[model samples]
Target: MEYLSNWAKNIVYYILFVKLISHLIPSGNMSKYIKLFTGVILIIVVMEPILSLPNMEQKIKSNILNMENIIAHKDFQSQSKTYSKVNDQLAINLYKKQVEEHIRKLVRGEDVEVSSINIKINEEEGKNFGEVVSIDMKVRKKNSSNDLSIEKIKIGADSTAYNITAEDIIIVKNIKIALRGFYNISPDNMNISVSQ
Candidate 1:
C-alpha cells in the first residue's frame, strides 16, 4: 500500500512538476545540470518500491523452520511405533521365561535343569493372544541315579518318542497338564517334547 501510494503521487505530479521545473530553469549551460539531477531523482523514486521488498534471507529462515517441525513430528511418530512393538515383544518373552522357570521349580528329585522353552503366540483384530502350540526342552540328570532312567518309559506310538527318555517327557507332560489345567487350554492343540 505504501509503494502504491508513492507511485500514485509520483505519476500525478510527474508531468506538472517536470513542466514547471523546466520553465523556471535558466535556459543555458545550467539547464543540462538541472535536467540530469531531475532524471536521477526520478529513477530513484521509481526504484524505491523494488528496493524496499522483503529479503530472501527471511523467507529461507521461515522455510527452514517449517521443514524442521515436519521432520521432528515424523521422527517422533516413527519412534513411538517402534517402542510399542518392542514393548509387546518384551511382554511375550517375559511370559515365556516365567513359564520355563515355573516348570523348572516343579521337578522333584535328581537335579533337573531345563535348557529352553518356547511358546507360539498369535494376533487377531488388533489384539494379540495365543496358546502354547508346542514345547521343546533339553533335560539332563546331574547325579548318577541307578533306579531311574528316561529311555525305558513309553510315551506314544512313534518309535522316536521312546528314543528320548520317558521320565524327561513325563515331567514335561506334567508341566503341560498343569499349564492346560491352569490356563484351561485344550490338550489337542499343544505338543510337548522332552529330550536328554
Candidate 2:
C-alpha cells in the first residue's frame, strides 16, 4: 500500500541522516546522546500507522459527544423542573380566584352583598390537591342605607318592631348552607362575617 511505501521511505531517510550525522561527529559522549535520541524517533515512526488507526478518531469523537449530551440533558432537566414549579403556582392562584368568584355568584340572590372573599386550597400533590380548604368572607346587607334619617313615630300598639340582627343571622345561615352544599366544606372551615 501507499502508506507502507511512505513509511519505509521515511525510515530509510532517517537512517541515512543519522549515519551522516555520526560520520560528521567523532565517536564521543555527544554521539551517544544523538544516537539515543534518533533511536526514540525511529521507534515512533515505526509505530505511527498503528497509533493512527481509523477507529481511534471515531471512538474519541463518540466519547466527546456522549459527554456533551449528558451535560445538556442535566441542564434541560433542571430548567424543566423550574418551569413546572412556576406553572403549578400560577395554576393554584388562578384556581383560588375562580373559587372566590363562584362563591360570590352562589350568594348573589341572597339579601347580602359580598364585600370580600378569601379562599384557601390544598397545595399538596395528592388526590386532594386544589380542593378548597377554607373560605373567609365579609358581607353586608344589600339594601342597607348609610345615612341616618329622622321619621315621624307611630307609637300606637299597631306597629311591629323588626329585629335587624335576627334577619342578618338568617342571611348568614343561608349563605353557609349554599357554600357547604356546593363545595362540601365544613362549617368550621368557613368564616362568614356580616359587616354593617
Instruction: Estimate candidate 1's alpha-carbon lDDT, on a 0 to 1 scale.
Output: 0.66
| TM-score of candidate 2 relative to the true fold | 0.61
Across 150-191, the per-residue lDDT of candidate 1 in tens digits comes to: 346555687555655656656666766776775565666555
For each candidate in the order shown, give its overall lDDT on alpha carbons.
0.66, 0.83
**TM-score against native, each model:** 0.61, 0.61
Show the lowest summed lDDT stretch of 10 residues, model 2.
148-157
User: Which residue pairs show backbone clashes in model 2?
Assistant: none
Which 10 residues in a row give candidate 1 its minimum summed lDDT? 123-132
- Deviating ranges (above 4 Å) for candidate 2: 1-65, 144-164
Q: 25-107, model 2: which lDDT tens digit per residue?
A: 88887977988988988888888888777666887899999999999999999999999999999999998888888888888
Residue 150 local lDDT, model 2:
35
